[model samples]
Structure formats: structure tokens, C-alpha cells
Target: MNSFFSQPTLQLAQSLIGMELVHESKEGITSGIIVETEAYMGPEDRAAHSYGGRRTKRTEVMFDQPGSIYMYFIYGMHVCFNIVSGPPGKPEAVLIRALEPVSGIALMEKRRYSSWKRSPAQARKIMHLTSGPGKLCQAMGLGLELYGSKMNKGPVFLKENKKIPASMIEAGPRINVHYAGEAAEYPWRFWLRGSPYVSKS
Candidate 1:
């Protein structure tokens, strides 16, 4: 298993700048170039820890060994997945926000179709296929079952790609974090510039 993913939170966040998110499902192994991500660092990060350092059964996995998966349900529906980083006892993770469809586009299209009732063309146009956090997880077939799973040696993991130039990368505040107060202002979100796959510009 590659240790790059097991590094510190900030390192993983920056190293993942140019990588691919490969998803293997019954449909096939669909891959996408990672275009956007956000880092949530431990209890101190007000944007993280719903209980603010209070660990519950749901968040217990976050305190597990690094490289574990931390998946949670939101909006009573969607599953958002994150890869835990940093040392044990220090909860930190990188959120995969957007992906540019690279391989197995057809499979992605089909999986996305099953989730939302949209025509192929409309799915490709209006839906963004693998854009939003929830949409990305849906298209990748990720859920609680994948929580605490290791991605480095599993069916899903990050793979290296050609280095994206600095000019092509941009940073901004995370989305839908109004409740985080000052933490919402943190510019932890990073994305590829001019990438159509980005959920938001």
C-alpha cells in the first residue's frame, strides 16, 4: 500500500492535488481526475467534529488509525466519504469534492442514471455526473459499508497523475458551511482551475 495517503493531513491534502479517484463497481472500474478537495483537521477545526471534540459512535472511526475511511450520511439521504489522515487520535481527512470523468465514462453515466431519473443527455448536462460530494459518492457507489476501509490496497484508491501547474490550481472557502461560523471562512478548498467537473467555480 502506498504510504503517501497515510501521511499528515496537510501533506495528503497537497499531495492529492494531482491524482485520480478510481472506483470499481459491478458496472466496471470507472476513474476520474480529482479536481477539487477540502481538508478538515481534527477537533480544533470548527468546521469539523459535529460535537466539537466529543467523540460518539458515529465519529469514533475518525479517531481510528490513519488511512481509514470516515463515511457519514447527510440530508437523511446522501453518503459523504472521507479518507482519514494524520496520526492516530488526531482526526483529519480530505474530502473529495469533484472529479473529471476520465475512464469508464459509460459506467459512470449508467450508475448516475440509476440514482436520478434523468435521460442520458440530461444526466450528462444537468447532473454533473461526479461533481458534488454526494453525487461523487453516488456515482462511485460509496456508503457506510466503505467506512473504516483502507483505500490504498482496496478497489478504490488515489493514483498519481501528471503534476498540475500552480496556475491551474485555485483555493477557496468550502461550500455549505454557513453553520461553521469563522471556520467557514477558512480557504481550505482547493480545485483545478477551469475544470468543468468542479461543482462550483
Candidate 2:
């Protein structure tokens, strides 16, 4: 499991673009093809939670072995899922941004937008379901409970899949990290080109 994430953070982020993220629970097995990811370059990256080599209860798993989960809350809500990468003590991670739903989509819809009184338009619902980090986490039922878990075991696991072609891959500055200063402009985000499931264009 840790070996799967032994690559540098940037390389792992790009390599994960075509893999399948599978979550199995009593509800059902909800799986999706990973289409978007963003890399945080350990302590030196201002956008990273472990920037400045800070250590805390929340970030301890990030300093553990590669392939560890590093989930955290934001804005007092929304759990974002990240995969710990790079070498131990380095604290780098790749944020899984978006997923193309592959199975159990109805379960995802039930988890995500079931509270709405009126059903949303079919096309819009599919696009909005797992199209963002928070949205995908909510849809796939990822939470703090999975934090520090290894990737290869149990409830959530990434399955190997066909590789995406370089021609279909794109990279750009990460989203919503303006406070990272110059690091905010670094092109560390990678995604599958022409994929509607990507968080943003």
C-alpha cells in the first residue's frame, strides 16, 4: 500500500488521474475513475497543511508512511480526502479533486442531494454529484474516520486501471489557494482533459 504512493507528490498526482477509487460499505460499493488531483509539496509548499514543518494531531498521519490517508475538515464543514505521498517525514499529499462515477451512482445521489425537496435536472445532477473534492467526499462517504488509514486495506481502496494518455492530461495552478503566495501559482494541479467530472475547467 505504501509502495503505491512512493513517488514524488507531483508524479503521484498525475499518475492517479486514471485510477479507480472504490468505497465499499453496507449501503453499497460506490466506485469512480479518478479524473482530477492537486499536489501539495510538503513543508516548502505554503498551500500544504504541513507547511513550515508544523506537526499536530491532525497532521501526524501526513508524516507517516506513504499511502496514508490525510482527511481534514474545512470552513467548519466538508471533509476533503488526501493521499499521503513522498517519503516519510516529508508530509507531501495529493488531494483528490474529482471523480467520474463508475458504479453505485444512485447511492451517491442519495448521499449527496437527497435532502432537496425537488429533484434537480438529470444532466445537472450528474455533473454536480462528484465534481469537487468536498462533493466527491460527501458522495462517496469519505470522512475523518478514514483518516490515517492505509490505502490498500478495508473500506476505501484505489484499484489499478488503464493509464490515461499524456495527450489527455492537463496541468495548471491549483484552485482556491491564493494565500499560498507564489506557491499558489505553481502548476501543481493535474486532470484529464475533456472530462466533465473535473472540478473546474
Candidate 3:
């Protein structure tokens, strides 16, 4: 993989449109066709915690070197993973939203099946397993333990997948960001149109 993540935040956000997110974990190497993503521009962007150059314990990592992982928990559950971008001191990142199962479908099925055995039918639905940020992280085994991990050369990273087409790419508003005020309206979300892996887009 040629470190497709080398680009700047916004460029990476756009370039990641058709990339593949691969994870080599104890369970096995599970790969997914990235279908959705959202960009958070550094500082000035209210939607980004690093906005206004506000640096806190949580936001500190966002200002670190680009290509680092910035993961956080929400709703007392759900771990969201973001790829840190932009130069040092500038907090920016791209939030991976959805992914289409490519390799290791069986392993994903097993993990999701174990997690949602009560609703096995839902487990059969691939989108349900990785459509949302939390679901994607859970399916990929990403967590706080992976915080600060390098995306360019880690067990998990992104690679180019030419199977995806530019025409299939689409952009829209990010999910659940009303708390960001006007920033919530920013159409930073990008996705592969009509892809089964795409969350209710």
C-alpha cells in the first residue's frame, strides 16, 4: 500500500472515497470497501473540537502528526475512529463512516453474530454490522487501545481499491452533528452511492 493517507485532511477525505480499510487482528485480516467518510477541518471549523485552537486532553491527540488515530467513546458506548490529518498543531481528521465487506466476511459474520446473537437476522445484514461509526469500529476491533496508532503502518490501515468508481462517490451532511450548530450543516460526509455498505444514505 502506498500510504494513500499521505494527503492533507480535505484531500484525504476526498481521496478516501474508494479506498479499502484493512485490519489484521487476532481474529484475522478483515477488509472492507470504504463507502462513507466525513472530514473535520482543523481549528476554525466549529464541528471539530480542535476548532478555535482549543486544546484539551481529548483534543490534544487531534493536533498530533497526521495519519494517527483519534478514537473516542460516545453515549457511554461506541468507539469512533478518526484519521488525524493536517500539520502539527492543526487538528484535522477524516471520520470513516461505512464500509462494504470485501475480505473476511466469514470472520465479520462470526464477530457480529456473537455480538448480536439475539437478533441473528440482523447479523446477516452486512450493513448493520458496519454502517455506523461505532458499528464499524466494533466490527473492525478498533478501540481506545488503538488510540495514537499509525494508520500508514499499523495492523489497520487504508489502501487503494480501484474497483470503486469516481461516479459512485457522493458527498453529504455528517450524521448526528446537530450539536455543532451551523457546522452540523457542513456537507463533509462522503459515500459511495447506492452501495449496500453505505448507512441509510
Point to the candidate with the largest lDDT: 2
TM for every model, in the order presented, reads 0.90, 0.94, 0.90
Candidate 1's C-alpha runs over 4 A off are: 118-123
Look at candidate 1 and tell me the lDDT of residue 184. Answer: 92
Tens-digit lDDT string for candidate 1 (114-198): 6565554552563388888888887777778888888766778777789988778888898888888898998888888888888
Which has the better lDDT: candidate 1, or candidate 3? 3
Expressed as tens digits, the lDDT of each residue in 43-81 for candidate 2 is 899999999998999889989998999999998879999
Off by over 4 Å in 3: 1-6, 121-123, 163-165
Error of 2 at 120 (Å): 6.3
- Rank ordering of all candidates by TM-score, starting from the highest: 2, 3, 1
What TM-score should be assigned to candidate 1?
Answer: 0.90
Superposition error at 71 for model 1 (Å): 1.3
Q: Which 10-residue span in candidate 1 carries the lowest summed lDDT?
A: 118-127
lDDT value, residue 7 of candidate 2? 85
Candidate 2, residue 57: how far the Cα is off, in Å: 1.0
Q: How many residue pairs clash in each candidate?
A: 0, 0, 0
lDDT per model vs. reference = 0.78, 0.91, 0.81
C-alpha positional error of residue 108 in candidate 1 after TM-score superposition, expressed in Å: 1.1
Enumerate residue pairs that collide in model 2. Answer: none
